[model samples]
Target: MKTVEKIERKLPVLKTRKRVAAYARVSMESERMQHSLSAQVSYYSALIQKNPEWEYAGVFADYGISGTVTKKRDEFNRMLAECEAGNIDIILTKSIQRFARNTVDLLNTVRHLKELGIEVRFEKENINSLSGDGELMLSILASFAQEESRSISENVRWATIKRFKQGIPNGKFTIFGYEWQDDKLVIVPDEAEIIRWMYAEYMKGASRIEIGRALMERGIYTRQGKPWVDSNVKVILTNITYTGNMLFQKEYCEDPITKHRRKNYGEMPQYFVEDTHEAIIPMDEWQAVQAEFKRRRDLGPFGNKSLKLSAFSTKITCGCCGKHYRHSGKRNTAGEVYYVWTCQTKSQKGASACHSKNIPEKMLQNATAEVLGLDEFDEDAFSQQIEEVIVIGDDTLTFRFYDGHEVTTKWQSTAKTDWWTDERRKLWGERHKRKDTNPNKHLFYEFTGFIKCGCCGANYRCQSGKRKDGTPTRSWYCTGPKDQCHNPGIRDETMKRLVTDVLGLDEFDEAAMDAQIENATILDHTVTFHFRDGHTESRDFLDKRHGTPWTEERREKARESMKAAWTDERREAMSERIKKIRSEKKWPNP
Candidate 1:
């Protein structure tokens, strides 16, 4: 227990000798107002020091800040701290509203200062906090000030909402990839390149995580000169602003009293302004991206959010614990934030389930590409290289790999590769096997190889892919018997329709494909094979010789002969077929 410090000196005597401090606040830090604040501080210090009856404590002014809220005004808080430290006995301010426009805040703060023997004087209000009944009148006036402040805030919001409904562009945050000249966005050539790269990568089936890494690797930075991040890339992908359009009032204050802003997709009228700014992404590309985003969004619960590749997620596979890593974002300078992938297992279980590990988004993307055997995601280069790999396998058909190794264009190299020995063939097959089993698998050329009727000598062109159109005319067209399989080979498109129909894949998009793959475990028995061109053929492998002249006797003899044959030629053919079958295998788990 300690004895209380008594006020041995009376207020009249103290008022004549006590150090007096003053506080002031200005809403903006304009040159003129800054000068005025400085003058006030100097004047008070000089006036107090010159007076023999008073001592100069200090003049604290919060410049370029609001007085309505004391929380953000550091200068005011410092003065309060000084008072608590027993450095000053009195505080002088311009008015009650200036002291604090918040009624509750004003009263509580003044009452606190008074208890520490620090009296606050509102010169305009002609009231001192320590005087009897002075606080009662101050609270009533402060309440009026607070109410006035609320009225101002409401008017601002109403005006903003009105402007939003009118499709007016408002606010100060500048859009990246565009320069604002005369209040309109114009494409900044350099920044626009980065934006274009983002959309291009995304359209080429790169995920947000991949896009972020690509940007960082290219020495590209955000509008704020910081490293790229997945969430930031996602935002860039989703923002219609890059399409030269915008939605005004996408978010609004959820709590009018507390002023908490939230997405107002349901509550407010959304205004879309198209071609309002110069485009960073083409309208067609933007449409494609948005279509993809909506398709992913419709996947529900298991949306593309989970598809994000965090740094740790790509490299670290859970041998026992199967939980995957997750990603998170944080704000940095320039009001931008970066995202990082982290081990969600550790985050949730606190090292019980897994260890805490994090990886940068860029690193993950590079690792994934490398794992997928696509060390360089240069589309042209990849296309050329893969084509080169395919051409060396067969020469009679003139089938060209799009990987730039066109047999016709690079015939000399193709001829050399075709002469690969048995050992070389085995090595090539092994390399391809490794590529297929890579965990960071990319969906490039997952469909490919073989569509021919052996009996007709009719080499049908088996298309392994299709266009975006929802028709079945795209699959295997009998180029006609070079040409013996008389049945005009089915359309590649028709093959996809037939296979999808049988597999119940009604949705014909990447998202649908992803879903089919995910549910593959449940439908693992519903086997099928997808061609490199995106055509799917059932894995039933039935021997249906439609074009063969198969009399009953000949058919029986062929089957019996096939069973007994074990020559080196037969073995060689079987080896090639086995290699091809393994090369063309798919999860079919869906």
Candidate 2:
């Protein structure tokens, strides 16, 4: 034991050291700055690894990242995280500016690293945060870095503003019809043809949707390879760029801090560069298309509504309830098809539904023809009545402003002179109860002025009903409410047939008038009717039921004839006596 104590053994000491890391950030990838950042990373890595007693950790570098604040610098933040986790005991960076240019960020981060037993060394400043007097030195150095950053930011702002003022465009927003080549607009021939076609077709009266469909059917896509849309067509039509002009600064981006992009409008200055690019659409044509577009838009809903149908299904109405009868053309097993009108209000309200009658489409058409005196036996009167009815209907069906509502005000029935109020129809069932006393009374009075509902003393004219097949059937109906009357309107087919018969037509020949017109030659108001079945008829001006080539003398004569026809013989004689002349041979001959 004494010998062992007297002997001293030499021991080898092993150094236990912490890993170190270096972080570097460059705001931009300019050639010189990029090389500088790379060199710093290499230098720091070698310096840490070369020490015999210490081990090399790693080096992190972030390019195109601002060093003004440590918060936004990814490499710096990652290094800090590692240091806080006790993996890194020291951090080396090129300079205070390279680490962080903001004094607040630098001081805060250094204080944080100090608490974690990690030290930060600024090479250029030759200072270490872990040193006893490091805080005082760091404050002075960080202030210089922040001032340098502010100067750089100001210079960048000045350069950007100067470039903008020199009429230089920024960013790389692509334009249609033209491709960018060497920073200049060059017309792509294929796209230019399509643009020309669009403008030409539009000015020639083709609609936007029609043009879009044509382009789509041809598999021609837009500059962005997107399917053509009507809105895009409209944009193309409105863009002045197609007319060889360029507009800049139509939009603005406010300061990032404020976060506002106010519209330039006319208040802000605008830059117009004319003839900067080849023209795709002519100016005159573009202007014309714009005008037409405005016109179509002004037409509102009517011009754009579907034009798929033209038949009795579109015309039949409920005589008693004042609702248009809906139609169904599907043939049943028996090969019988029907058109009927329904009460829309009742369908939604269930048990509280209306008891409106449904009549076939033919019935309403027949009724219209008969009331207008258009039957085969009355050939002359039929043609005359058709023309007169067309004139009156067209005149009556006009738009009018009523109580902030644009209403389609029209005569519901020509024979009865009943005007339909759209607002009244919409509010009908909601406010008023159906009168059971005279269910059909209002039908004849309101629609036909002749037919009357037999059961409830209501006018019997038009009513819509639903059949077992869920199809609407329209007919004249009792004016009574759903709880009161079951009277339905006459079948629209029956009315049509009767009216056709009244017109003296053997059968329903829709092409009769058209064929007659095609066969006859007219030099103004003269027309001759030739039936397909070999019957020919002619009417002179005096024999025409409706006044033609309307003249004051003809009008007066028609009034006299109507007066004589409407009054009794005794009153007629008195009218004839009061007239100046009965038969004048002094009248001019045509």
For candidate 1, lDDT tens digit of each residue in 173-194?
5777887777777788998888
lDDT by residue (tens digit), candidate 2, 1-590: 45544567879987887688888777887999899888878888888888775567799899997776556667777877777677888888888888877788889989988888888888888998988899999999889878877777667656655655665665556777887887667888888888888888876777778888899999988877898887898778877778877776676644322224676787656677677667877778778878877886895433443322333332333333444445546553324454443444434453245555443344445444545445523434433333211112222322212223322323333321222256644444322222222334343322232233434544444566687789986554445565766544444455445434534797755444334322321112222344556665443221222234688998899999987787687787886665535435444433
Q: Which candidate is the best by TM-score?
A: 1
Quality of model 2 by C-alpha lDDT: 0.61
Q: What is the lDDT of residue 385 in candidate 2?
A: 34
Clashes of 2: 59
**Model 1 stretches astray by more than 4 angstroms:** 1-16, 29-47, 165-167, 254-259, 298-346, 349-590
Error of 2 at 198 (Å): 8.5
The number of the candidate with the highest lDDT is 1
lDDT of 1: 0.63
lDDT of each: 0.63, 0.61
